[model samples]
Target: MAVSHGHKGINFAQTTSICLNFIQEALLKHQWQRASEFLQHYFQALEDFNSQKRQVALQNIWKLGSAILYHHPKSNVETFNAFADRMKNIGVQNYLKISLQHALYLLHKGMVEEAYRNLNQAESWRYGEMSASQEKIIKLIQAYRGLLDYYTWSKKRTELSKFDMDGFATSAATQDMHSYFRQASVNLHEIIKIPGVWDPFVKSYVEMLEFYGDQDGARQVLTDYAYDNNFPSNPNAHIYLYKFLKKEKAPEDKLISVLKILHQIVPSHKIMLEFHMLLRKSKKEEHQKLGLEVLFAVLDFSGCTENITAWKYLAKYLKQIMMEKHLNWVQEGWSSRKDWWPTFHFSYYLAKKNWKENKILALEKAFTSGILLGKGCKYFMYVSKQGHKVQKKSIKTMKKFVMKHNILDSEEL
Candidate 1:
């Protein structure tokens, strides 16, 4: 059903409050499907309200837009445009942030000139001395301008532009890629010196250094970026250093050191899979255990939830670890977990060791009804041609896969 602003008693703020309350309630219960329905209803009401009226508190408007960006998976360019336009129409304070974000969206879409124009608009708002945050924004604007100039030069590499030649050296009369890179370097240099996550600026500076055959400089810059105490704890900084070292063919021990530190920081980093695979082949037992943890993580990923291969590996590994006790473990999901791990291989073993057609049908019927997982759902309809009430015990493996400290090698306590 659609809500109408024409309703005499209904208010936008009240509607927003009610809609968000229900949506959040659903989300708290891990009911994403229900939350999605509530979200759609809220947006539908918003659109209806927009047709009749556009006046609202800026905070309310911000909240409305933020719901999509933070909660919805389908947020995109058009959504951002709508959000920025809403903010701009009300002459929102800190307006440069709106332009800056819009500029980033344009850059993402490859609208380089348009993005530069947005940065220019943002920069124009500055007057007199700026605050620390404003200063950061200004530097970002200049950094983006450097990127724009570099992009322009790239398109015109062989563009017959005049050059200023010096003994065995020459510089373009107008800004070229090299000169633009230098400009980017200078703009980025000071910004990176202060400890902070300067992803874009640091990347630009490092790339410039590498292009100018300053490998040593690039290495040191990445080293400082990763290890500097002034910077917040960040895994990507270390990952950047690790990649740089790998590309430079740094020693094995050095590569391992960075990887170890990164793993200690973010154990479930996707890149750790390759390292774990090699660890699996190592002669050490501890390394082998760590290797299998990656498979567990792979299975935990949304798309890989149904991955049978990973399930099989973990089951076999579990059996190996348990030895004689493997068979003693019930084939049914009577036990909460397949050991105390983050994922279980219940499906593989359940199907293999005990697959009576009737038992499968019963399980399906249980899922489709309020008997096992609660509330009947049509999504599980295909699992059984006919569903009837079944005992909750028939269902197996609601393994609490909460990964509190999944990393095996604990930091020294």
Candidate 2:
């Protein structure tokens, strides 16, 4: 009873300071659970402070708490509950921070419905408090747009479609919708027109172009972006550019350069396999030879045991090339494997082309293997059906031969 001050004597400032120190200690020790607990008590103490100055104290607490929560990697129910409770205690005067933190927390927790609700509320409630910094407002807008972009890229189309962009524009802090659009357009224009801006800027620029239905402009931008940037150093970028050029029917030389860069990057089995497929599609004999050499080199390094898909492609390519060149050794090598039933079918195709001159008997060996009975039966029927009417006798022989090796019953076939 000497001064009769009691707990109130400590003052809100002292309580806040002590709480901050405890929070710092918990963070340093990586005790997020304990840190959230401390923040709950700290916010409660602030709520109990003098009513006249409570608004200022609440605003200060929210700012500091948000900074902490935003950077922490691991957040949980307790962390969000603490933030929500502080917002409720602070009243509507601190609504923007309250709603923003709630939205962010819900987003982190994968509760998108609740996050969208809170974001809408935050946008609606935001007042002149944000008038101090246009840059901060721009950052906030970007954050919202970034979340939209995430949903778009990740194929969450239904969720992205639910968002009301018009509503967002109406409630946004900027002067008008054109300001946002202008800023975005300018950024993307720079991305396409300037060098060294490709990495950080292409994704956004492409997205914006897509949104506006500017397909031709988007293609042009991609062309310029690829031209200004070095594609050879990055195989993935090179492939993406190559695919784009292929779709546009760009010069054969441009596509060949892509293949050359890929070959230079690594002699990996997959890359060699892709090169062979591309060369065959382009119908370039010299490139096909080079691709074949690379494929053989890869086989030497890793052997034919690995890369089953590559083996399938290589076998098909070899069958086609050997047929065109009339190489008997290639056909002999192809028949040596139990798994080359498909190659036998390819050989059947070539033999059918010159059936009278070739005297092909490989189909007899293939039918005996029973490997071509299931899926191969349908292909055999298709080829037999395509025979000339004058070769109707051969067709009949083929049909009877296929029926003998058919995997399914007569009705099923």
Candidate 3:
């Protein structure tokens, strides 16, 4: 239900807060179905509020809509289209993102003509310098449009059963299709030059080039663009660079050198994890010591708030090395963002550390927070003798699946 300003008691902020709190609760409970239902009411409330305070509602709707889209990919097309219409009603300029989402969804469903129209509408709205986020969205739309045309033409080229009688027309269409990919390549390169777009653009650009059998060209383009700005801020670019170097058969030293530089610039979760893997794979005597340093550095850098993959490996390695000094920091980081990593995963680590006092509390907290029983039951068994009162049928099914997969010891879902 939506509250209007005309309602005697409630103000707009209270109504908005109530809606947001509802969404948050649904998300915390992993109730995507409930969240989807709440989103409809939230937008209705926004519409009612907008009827009175148009500007305020217009400014806030995009953020909430984007959040819903990001979190609820399974949201139906009707709902998504409604959101796009709302955005268009607010201002055509603000509809660019929802327009792109609509186009992509249509394209995925093989609605080519409708997707093309949506893309054209998005393209027509381009005018001035936009926010970094908006520019990224625009670039994505352009890249998708180009790639879609190329794929559509390729499909046409393959279905040449009737082309025997109209050879000239078929050949002309083939040439046009080739031109589509070529034009797309050029457009993607231009998009790559835009700030905040380089990382994503490079992935698609490189994929396009490699798909056309120009691996060397793709590597060079990625390298040139990534290194052009010496102080690289995007961690994915570095990760991509490392991947390119590895594929090219570069030596371990060269890979390590690049990772060293990458870690200096943007030591993100994936990057740190990759660097840790490379160190372990190299397996030199000093590599172990160096890897531990890098692992501790990652804890310091990110506060252990991200990268459970790295944390798992680090925890196992610490067990091997018999290290105990930095364990406190590890615990701190894991506990800080219990929502991101499974509470059982962290609790398992705590159990191993002989931190029995915190282990049960963490398990109870995770249990109360609604972590899936199937995902955490094994860890719970390790730290506590008493079961979590999980359904017997669910536990039996989980055990069968775990035994079949031979991952009974794994902490990940």
Candidate 4:
């Protein structure tokens, strides 16, 4: 429960817990500086301890390092360097886990040479002492190496202009860079084949292949590393797969599969909107109608009126259907919603018979909503020209509305 350090008996577990609590609280409050101080104190307290204590200390330090990297990147370089030095001083015998963290930090900081040195030191440690997870970490480091090689080569090749190259020189150089990156991609794929390196390993390879204009290759990599039925559960992964499918111009069925996956993952307004857009583009009339049905269902369930854009779209669609079917309910349904009056502006252009009346009504509603004009004399003049046969009550209403809005001075009005 507690370990005595020197002057006072330190409750190691309690102190660690307190430190973690402080770190999380500070992070939640966006106090990165205080969080970093607490983390440093926490890790320093665990130094000079034995293996079990050191493992706990190292894990905390690694987490601290990750927090610094993600949340306080610009100001945490010194913290990262100090952590790296601490890991190095722990010696290769105790450095397997920390090595990957240090290497990643070094790579992020663009110290590729130092990162490789750390990786080499980690590799030279006695293999039999290493756990299976540590072996997986080493494979991930290999994948990181391949990533570094590909990026470095790509940078160099991009710096060379086409005009700077002679005929044979250009051809030869092009072949070399292509071959190098292709090999790097292959090496990354090989690491992916080794199970348990899922997150960054597969993600990085997918990104690299996608960046290199190899959509098919990237899709294949995802398929190979696929998590069986557990797939389509991650919203981000589903979005990525959908993008790839869209890029490939895969059939409507494939796009529908992604929409289904998205529906299963999380039922949200955004997902519904994307499904509607995709179905509309795919020209699946039945599916588009289904998407509208789903939208209406979600609207009823959530009562989410924040999406004015979706409302506008529905209004336009309803207008079209009303014109085609000569349905009064469609027009009434659209006109009843005061919040959606702006959408009827588009309908005015397409309302064949009632175009003029609809246009005037849309403008009137827009003016009343304080949207068309900023309470200027010009706006009042424009409203006057509408010739709405302003009654005394209507004039009183206009004056009250203008006064209630307080949007302009008396002289301005």
Winning model by TM-score:
4
Q: Mind giving the per-residue lDDT tens digits that candidate 3 earns over 1-413?
A: 54344667776577766776777787777776676666666654445544555545554555556556656758666776677777776664457766877787676667888898888788768656677777777777787776666566456556654457567877787677667668667767776666553665577668767767898888887676657675346666767878888887889877887788677776655567767777867767566556666765665543553444554565455544533333333333334444544443444564445324443343332232222233344454453443445434433443443333321232432
Task: Tell me the tens digit of each residue's lDDT in model 2 across 1-413.
Answer: 11123556775667666776777787778776677667666665556547755676577567656656655678556775677765755575555556666666777777776676665555555445455443343345344534434343434334345665666544552234324445556634643353343443555556566666787776776665555444325455455566666766878667777667666665673656666666666666666666555554454343542344554455455545544653433323333342654454334553354334332232332222222343254334444555566656755665564455333332322
Segments in model 2 whose C-alpha atoms lie over 4 Å from true places: 1-74, 77-184, 188-204, 207-216, 229-232, 249-253, 266-274, 293-306, 318-413
Clashes of 2: 0
lDDT of 3: 0.60
For model 3, which pairs clash? none
On the 0 to 100 scale, the lDDT of residue 175 in model 4 is 76
Full-model lDDT for every candidate? 0.56, 0.53, 0.60, 0.58
Worst 10 residues of 2 by lDDT: 362-371
lDDT for each residue of candidate 1 in 354-379, tens digit (9 for 90 to 100)? 22444543343223121112222222
Model 3 TM-score relative to the real fold:
0.50
Candidate 4 local lDDT, 1-413, one digit each (tens): 12224426556666676777777888889888778778767775466366777766666666765776567746566766676667656555446667777788788778888887777776666645677777776777667777766666666567655358679878888777777677577768877676543555566667667767887788876655444453334566566666677778888778777667666556563766767666656555566555555444334333443345455455444434433443333323323343443343323232222224443432333233332223443433344334445333443455445444422232322
RMSD to truth, every model: 13.9, 15.7, 13.1, 11.2
- Judging by lDDT, tell me the better candidate of 2 and 4: 4
lDDT: which is higher, 3 or 4?
A: 3
